[model samples]
Target: MRVFAQLFEAIDSSTKTSRKVAAMVDYFDRVSDEEKLFAVALLIGNKPKRPVATTSLREWASALAGIPSWLFEESYYAVGDLGETLTLLMPQQSRPEETPTLKAVFATMTALRKYSPMEQRETLYTFWTTLRGTALFLFNKMLTGSLRVGVSRKLVINALARHLDRDEATVAHQLMGKWDPLTTRFTDLFPQQGTALPHHIPYPFYLAYALDREPADLGDINNWLLEKKLDGIRGQLIRRNGELFIWSRGEDLLTDKFPEFGPLTTLLPDGTVIDGEIIPWKDGHPLPFARMQTRIGRKNLSAKMLQEVPLVMVCFDLLEYEGRDIRHEPLLIRRAQLAALIDNPALQRILLRSEEMAFPDWQAAADFRERARQFHCEGLMLKQWQSAYGVGRRKGDWWKWKADPFSIDAVMIYAQSGHGRRANLYTDYTFAVWDGDTLVPFAKAYSGLTDTEIKSLDRWIKQNTVEKFGPVRRVKPVHVFEIGFEGVQASNRHKSGVALRFPRMLRWRLDKTAAEANTKDDLLDLLRLYGQ
Candidate 1:
């Protein structure tokens, strides 16, 4: 735990990726294989489940500290971090304690669930007293099941790859999918050379950069293949070794999540990997993104749900065809191959082709970008026809020209402390729009304000806070801001009767007043216009 704490501090404090990887490698060099595996898992958000609920821990901690629950809540609001707050409030030990190993601490968590309530309280009280500083903060994080640091899983994988002298992509593939650090050994995970990957696992996805200039700046429009930028999950549907596998961009295997696509294994031939969008489509057009979340949010789909959110994999590019790695082939060739694979009637419904658009010039492409909202798409994706499918985010091959977001003027109703670096600042805000004379909460956005703007807002929030509710503050509805959103949907769950998709602060519209802000009617008009 102390070693992990040291590594966490070193990694979290460092800004550069090289320094982060160095910190990980430095710790890995000293730790046992089991400890190293656990470190990887912890870094990648695979923390042990909470042995005891945070509510129980909090109640016990407040009682133990001889502090009122209200005082503890107030402290938590100020700190904005659950783990660090609890650690600070708890009484220290009488004598210094030996630091436990990472594996030992994790073992204690698994053992804690079986203990009686009183026993659990005693165990936790002792931990609070015994653990100190960064270890305590990290302990609290693990206990809460959100042990995140500054480093990414990619950095951890890169470090492991460098340490073991293995291919980075190979190491990344090895780390994918579910594995218990307690049972699955480091050697077992990364086997000796010549071990074949499980056929279902997907290759690294090829992402595109945003197009800042007109398409004409990139040369001829004939050299580009244009497709509607889908507001859907980036997915890889693989038909390999006579089995089908669906994977999200997050590397989560969604084979069971969307059981409707299980039949595609039989439809597409073996050794075919298609990179495309997983979208909820009913007729010819896509349903709203909020509608798609209905399917994605559930682990198990009911019969009614399956019918309600019928998703189609809009197949576009072919990575693997006929048991050969064809990613090096030009996208033009890949598209033709993908088209041929989905030509069958069986695949027509299950695997829809992401048909390319014919544009005479860049002007036509720009025109299409503005009208993307009609099709419920974000905007245009321009791919170089001759460019090979590059790994990760490469600049030359592809570009995404997203449409301008729908803007509205809304008043900030509430402000809350954010997590990570922004934890100390009141960055997150709940905004409201007019409803007759009342201000009804519509959306809560946390990003899009500049650092200078945020710092200035934070000072103002502290000075003008009208009331406090745990970590959130009900602020005076005096500031009006321009809020930008991708889409809107009618939702019975919200007071505004409509929900904004990807809502964020465009700018603090100092020019406007709360009285002149947008109304519920305005949001409803947007819902009718775009939430089809």
Candidate 2:
């Protein structure tokens, strides 16, 4: 546990990827196999269920520190993080005679749910006195399920692959599906004999980076394959050993969520895995993304609801066929195989192949890209004809040329503090649009500002605050910001009767005033034009 805590500090304090990877590799080298397995699980966001209520934890910490509850609350508001607040407020303890193991600590946490609240508090107090410094901080964070550091899953995979002297793609593939760290072994995760993997496991998705240059800069359009970038959940449909499994890119199991696709288990050949997008289809076109959200997380879907928002997996590429892995094959060959598999009369309604778009040149492609919103597509995907399905995100082979985001000038009406590094600054903001003489809150954005800009705006927000409501401050609407979003739709839940998708600050419109900002009518116009 002490070594793991040191590793946490080392990872959190550094911004360099190489330094972080080195720290992880060194930690893996020194830890037990069980510790390495759990560490990998935690690093990849498979956190254990939080066992204790945060309110109870805060009250117990304040009692242990001999500080008043009001003082602790004030400290938490200032700290902006419960874990950090508890670490700073609690009194120091004497060093333990022996350090605890990560697995033991995890076991203790998982068992807390069986105890009563009083028993839980007593156990936590006894456990808290045995640690000091980073270990104590990490323990609190683990209890709160907020142990985040500056490392990507790719970096962790890289470090593990280097330490084990294994292929990076193999290590990545091993980490994909459901596995219990408590029972899993390091050797089981990365086998030496090229053992068969679990049938439910998915391959590491091949992601595309955004294209920054013009399409014409790529040299020739004939050398690329073009397809509409559908706005849907990217998933992999696998049929293995007469069983069907649909895994989202986030690693969520969607088999029961979309029962309509269950027939594909018999329709598709054994040991076939196809990569595609799961979209809500109606009348041969995709419904709005907002409509798709209605069918998500419904374990038992009503027949009426399924009929209204039917889902179809638009196949893009074939990953496996007839029990063989074909990811190394060229895109041209893979697409041809996928087309042949999806061209079935029985699978027409449930599975549709993403049709390749034809264009004479880059100029024609650009012109077609402008009309992507009409077909409910995000934009165009350009894939190299001879590219292979690689792991994670790689440049040069696949690129996403997205349509320009819709922009509107809106006024900053409320401000809130951010967590982690921006804990002390007013980095989150609520934007409003004019509704006659009233200002209606439309969107809240928290990104797209430089460090200098955030600091400057934080100062302005502190001075312009009109009223306080807990962590949120109602600020005077004096500054205007250009807010950008991918799509807009009519929403009864919003005060403006509209909602924006992926809203973020594009730039600070210093030359514009609150009075000159866009109105609710302008948002309604966007909904009419882009709304499904």
Candidate 3:
């Protein structure tokens, strides 16, 4: 346990990717077989390998070489993490006085090997029985890859520096060295100060925090820089010390996902990172989100997927340029620097040219977003020119001024039980539109209603069930709710040849009659924007 803690401390210090990887490989090479099993599980994080499904101890144990899921469930119910469970299961003397940190556990776990099914189950059970209180909670969070300490990866980098008495850049290098996160150790690969590390490019640092009310009035739309709110992944392209790193908003490295932008490496200003959105675009407009979904996580994509969902980098904000860190600079300053950095808009791949557009009023911005469906856009992004880069949440500096959703008062025709907390309640719903004389099922949306509303609806579903299709309960089409969506697209997969983007229930339209529900023509109008 102490050894694990020490390794985590070392991994914490490592900023360079090489150092982290080296540490992980070294640590994994040394642990005992029993310890190795738990270590591997820990490396994979405390979360179960997949979504929690119905399982018995014998069945699960058999699958994991005879280690029962009960063991893990017990440990998770106890200490929360498998490591702590191991600690609890071990003899008191074997349990180290000091608990190891998460990073140490990560390093220790990565160096280990695949455990037998039985040993894995035993380890899991022991882990649960031993872990307790806050430790258990943190362990559970780690299992889900969410340490939720309000800590960002950058903040972790800072923590590493503080732990190792090293500079940030040195530590950053150690951090970025490997692709396999499980095996990287931070301590052994810690870089010395002033090391010729990878140069990081300037990327926009996005900050969005929800406000109780509007943050700023914008005076008129004229003062704001408004651009279409694209429905795609946000990308941060960084070029530091000549090495290129492109990251998603979720901080996942995505350089390999879009090869078309790879050539832009030569044109990019070194030691810079810029923020942008990566969308599927061809010819002159944006592609559907489903198109880009095809090529997202593949290490090597099929040629069909590549041609089907080609990518475009829609550059938004610039954070770093040349050698200067412009995150501290105002948004207006960053815009000017970004403009000067990319001299050719015509050649740039789908850059969000908000500066050139006349945003002179919020209404104009809203109007543009309203018509954005024509351009296959989600909505609009309204940014304050004077704001500086701030991490996490909506600050006053930026706002996503998306158009109001495409709403329809629809009748709830079916209901199904939800998972986890709502496992007993019929919360999932299948909504329909009154087409001609029949209620044709057009969508199934389960979210957007409150727990109270769900409970009420749950009772109604049970009392009104006309028929049951396994877990799904067919209900009378008497309830009406307003459904909201980002965009509508035509699809042969459905009866209406219409699919809603980001569909969610806004409110129960009890005030509206079934006859007041949106017509099939409304769906057709929106789908026409997709050229179907």
Pairs of residues clashing in candidate 1: 1-102
C-alpha lDDT score of every prediction, in listed order? 0.86, 0.89, 0.61
Ranked by lDDT, the better of candidates 1 and 3 is: 1
Residue-wise lDDT of candidate 3 within 1-532, one digit each (tens)? 4444444545557666556545555555576433433443344333223212224332442343334565555543334233334333433333323444445444433322255545545554444344443444344345334432222455555545555566655455455422333443333344355554434322324656432344246465555666667788887877766566778765567787777776666767566777878888777777778777767756788878777777877777887777766777887889898877777754376354433456555555556767876656656676776778765454566776565677877888888766434556777788888667777777889899998999988888879989866556788778899999876766676676677777899999878877777767767776775532
Q: List runs of model 2 lying over 4 Å from the truth.
A: 94-98
Ordered from best to worst lDDT, the candidate numbers read 2, 1, 3
Better of 1 and 3 by TM-score: 1
- Which rank order by TM-score, best down to worst? 2, 1, 3
State how far residue 233 of model 1 sits from its true place (Å): 2.2
Candidate 3 off by > 4 Å:
1-48, 51-204, 209-216, 220-223, 297-309, 344-355, 359-363, 419-425, 435-438, 466-471, 491-497, 512-522, 530-532
Residue-level lDDT of model 1, residues 402-519, one tens digit each, is 9999999999999999886788999999999999999999999999999999999999999999998888899999999999998888888779998888899899999998999999
Which candidate leads in lDDT?
Answer: 2
Q: After superposition, how far is residue 387 of candidate 2 from its true place, in Å?
A: 0.3
Listed in order, each prediction's TM-score against the native is 0.94, 0.97, 0.67
